[model samples]
Target: YKSIIKTIKDTPLEEFYTSGHRTCQGCESALVMRFLAKAAGQRTIVIGATGCMYVANTTYYSTSWIVPWVHTQLGGSGAAALGTAAALRALMRKGKIKQEPINVIAFCGDLGCADMGLSGVSNAMTYDYNLLIVLYDNESSANTDIQETSMTPYGAQTSFSRPGKQRRIMKKRWKKSVVPMIIAGHRNIRYAATMTPAYPLDSINKIKKALAIGGPTFIHSLDPCPKGWDYDPRFSHELGVLAAETGLWPLYEYTDGEIAYNEPTKSIVEGRMKRKPVKEYLEKQGRFSHFTEEDIEHIQRMVDEMYEEWEIPGVMPIKSL
Candidate 1:
């Protein structure tokens, strides 16, 4: 454990965004934010949106940023990031901030990306702004106590989409696939989907690739919210692994229209790769404990269908899992 800590420390301070701050207990976004900053390096600037991350990590008196950071409105982080990228370019030309190039990074929640900042994020991609946008997808509007968002999984009960005899469904709508939607709008940038704690190495590699690509990039990150998910804080990393293993969140990257899916673990034959059932991932959360076997089966089917549709290579069918 000490060796692991030493390696993490040696990775370089410029790679993470947050250095010192107090985030809420069971909050998973903090981990991803730090990793992103570290990947973007010291010369980067981050444009944050109003969400759990913005409020919990950054307050009036103190902050966790080691780089230039800007907090934008709930629906305008992407646009703000674009403007910052433009300004930085202009500044570099005039030798203002420096003559060297820098990375412009953006961070926001699913609500900000899929709902409020959808247009702004889309436009940023369309304009081909040299920015890296990281959407912290926690499935629920966790800041508001696990409210349903368009990205929330089906058959999962939320205050907005309660499951009962009258309601009968968890979330009536399909998840808004923001990565594909962004691709449809802008063909110039790379896109990827990743999960925290589960695929840290892949996540790190993706961020590095995004920075080196020299164009706009979008990374949809699945960061488990323990408070909302009703799991022990210690289970955050395990939950992330379960999510990928269940095919609920596949570890994949889309670069310039091409898609690459990361295997859930090192190998399938070893049995180490087979993730626990979705029930293990969902059952710990009060939100999903209410689901019956039939409901569970329905959710399982959806997960399987998604894997097939995505044509995720090396992923055994859900039935096998």
Candidate 2:
């Protein structure tokens, strides 16, 4: 990593993903793109899946990306990234292109990564190629009118999982713990982490580190959607912060075959800080608007067990030795 962004002041004054796209007013996914661009700088190729980022960022001829960007299929993040990297390596080998480091970042939404593109992503991690895959999870398939995705949290409302008289909560599945899943399923991956724009400096560090790391890496980012979550745009950042504060979304990284929690989450783990109530988090969004007191309590219980009993907190459960 040539430039390590330490604090707000240390951040680059230059903006790579400048303002031009038509993302929602409080779209944290846009922030993820901006941060990724800044961290990687100009010498990067961002492979975008057919999701919100692709649609919103490229409307007609205009685009926000300052560096090279390409459009891939809906479920093609893994294959696209690997192919691009391999092509670059081949070009360098045959003396067709300049032999230099060029960061490759392929991004996908929750559905694209956790569901559609998971197979290709799995295979990519097993390869010796250097690339980074970012899953910008808003929980729902926000671009497709807020449908239920596997990464969507339990009790949250979606177009398909809408609450009705027959079933109060159509979605009974818990949020998939993706980072840990990747860490366990793919031992060859050099780095994996969870980040949010609420902590931009920390996220920048993660992006830089992932690029610097020798092998395939993945990052799952929790994004608060004002439209899908049914909240005012103004509260996006606050909601993102609350997610970490309440342990609903943990900030952590898996590296060197070990896992570690970051910042606020680290404090919660060490007992230096207490995780706020999950109710405080759920009450802010309309997706959980249908959640009853019982439902909220259930989620709270899950979070409690995660910290008090889980061997790796949000990543793994440990009830037995």
Candidate 3:
């Protein structure tokens, strides 16, 4: 660890992502962007898609990124990155852009990644493009005022699927299982699902691993949006950590050839056995503000089922909802 620290200290953090932007107070996405760029170092190109991050970090006449950056249409970031990588690779072969190796990283939100950018990402992975796609999933489309996305949990209300007497169900549809979906597409690619604030060290490590790989890599991060999650700005990290501990979200990585679970605290099983309830975390967010006792129980049940089905080593099997 001491040698690792010394090596990191020797590397410069600046000259990559410079400060000065107007991102939201509790948005974990910005912090994630900073860490990833830092890990990738100075010779990198970032492809930004339409989302809260794009609006805040690259408003007209101002930009936060210090590296070579390009913004593309929301649905085309993956493709754009693919194009950029192709052009860069071709240029290097022809001695056009200094022939120096460069890293290409794409950034997108939940809606953009799981919903809009799915096909392009799938195609890029299938082609084995040299790029890293970071899905900054804050659950809801926080930048657009919290509309429901496929990643939104059951009993969690968004404007699109708000609970009411007539339609009193939080997303009745299951959250889209994107990790497996991506895995099915490109077995050669490295894939991992992570959460910000809760597992920053693990998160950083995963980013480092993905960068080391030669082909396309996916790192999905569950960033908490305090404004959308309906919590205090400072509680963003706490909420993110609680979600993983409650079995609603698990800290795991898929790479090499199998899946590896990263449960640093053994909190999911232990916490479920002795803690007050999952309601404590749900009650903190306005997304689940309308959930009744029965609704909360339903959510817990789903979490339990997922836990059992996923079979994460060292974690207890979840009971059915």
Candidate 4:
């Protein structure tokens, strides 16, 4: 049994996801891949679905992954994960290889995981397979020229949802509820959580725990995209931090059939720390550049209702957890 990582000093210097990719500058999703790979260590097999990480990182002669990696269809991450784990188990039993536990992880973006891949992931949750599915949601179809996805945040401008004089606001739909769907529908799921790359330690620890627990697990990560979110590349990490601090995104995990909110978010809920204004979070991004005071207030009210009225913040709206 390995010891739990409590500090940055505790993390090792060796990196498993080395520098070979052609990702955008200040890409938080790239960091998501980096940290998850670091947490999973070298004894891991990664499945990359059709998305930014796969399209931008891999080529015929070159690759970024140090561990074994494979690419699957857009919505096939979960099914591929189940097949991989089952095959590993079968191989050991058949004496083709030594018996040991190996970490199996799959990563997909919002366009793949939330839109096309949703059904495959939902169905895969029922099986008792040892694997982790990470939804690295940048809120749009970024790799395919930034088209809108179901998980795109409200009032944001995308290629498909571009704003014009005829319509000032393009995207009207709220960010789709993802982790909650996993928690509610999959009764036997061992671990489910929401995190952002802004908090590296918290994100890494969550990945570690999800892998430690047996059975299929899911983690939804809100990665800040400089291009998609229309922010300066330098503020990618800060934008992620502001997202959680403003209560627009709440950090929490579901395990052992109970819900627990992480730090700062927990502090905000308990009145120890005040959640920053939504305007502060919005004004930093170019996507919300067209937002008026009324629009900002509208979003604030939605965020307020989520943290104040909902039973599990953004998960369920019941009276109690």
Instruction: Name the candidate that leads on lDDT.
Output: 2
Instruction: Return the TM-score for each candidate structure.
Output: 0.86, 0.98, 0.88, 0.97
- Candidate 4: which stretches are off by over 4 Å? 1-3, 319-321
- Tell me how candidate 3 scores on lDDT: 0.75
lDDT of 4 by residue, 1-321 (tens): 153588988887878888979889999999999998999998899999998999887966788889899999999998899899899989999999898889999999998899998998987789988999999999999999889999888888888988888898888888888988899889999789999999999999999999998689999999999988888899998999999999988999999799889876889888899899999989998888888899999999999898888877756755564
Task: Put the candidates in TM-score order, highest first.
Answer: 2, 4, 3, 1
Flag clash pairs in model 3.
301-321, 308-318
Error of 3 at 267 (Å): 6.8
Better of 1 and 3 by lDDT: 3
Lowest summed lDDT across 10 adjacent residues in model 2 is found at 312-321
Best by TM-score: 2
Please identify which of the two predictions, 1 or 4, would achieve the higher TM-score against the true structure. Answer: 4
Model 3 segments beyond 4 Å from truth?
1-15, 265-276, 311-321
Clashes of each: 6, 0, 2, 0
Model 3 compared with the native: what TM-score? 0.88
**lDDT, candidate 2, residue 122?**
90
Which residue pairs in model 2 clash with each other?
none
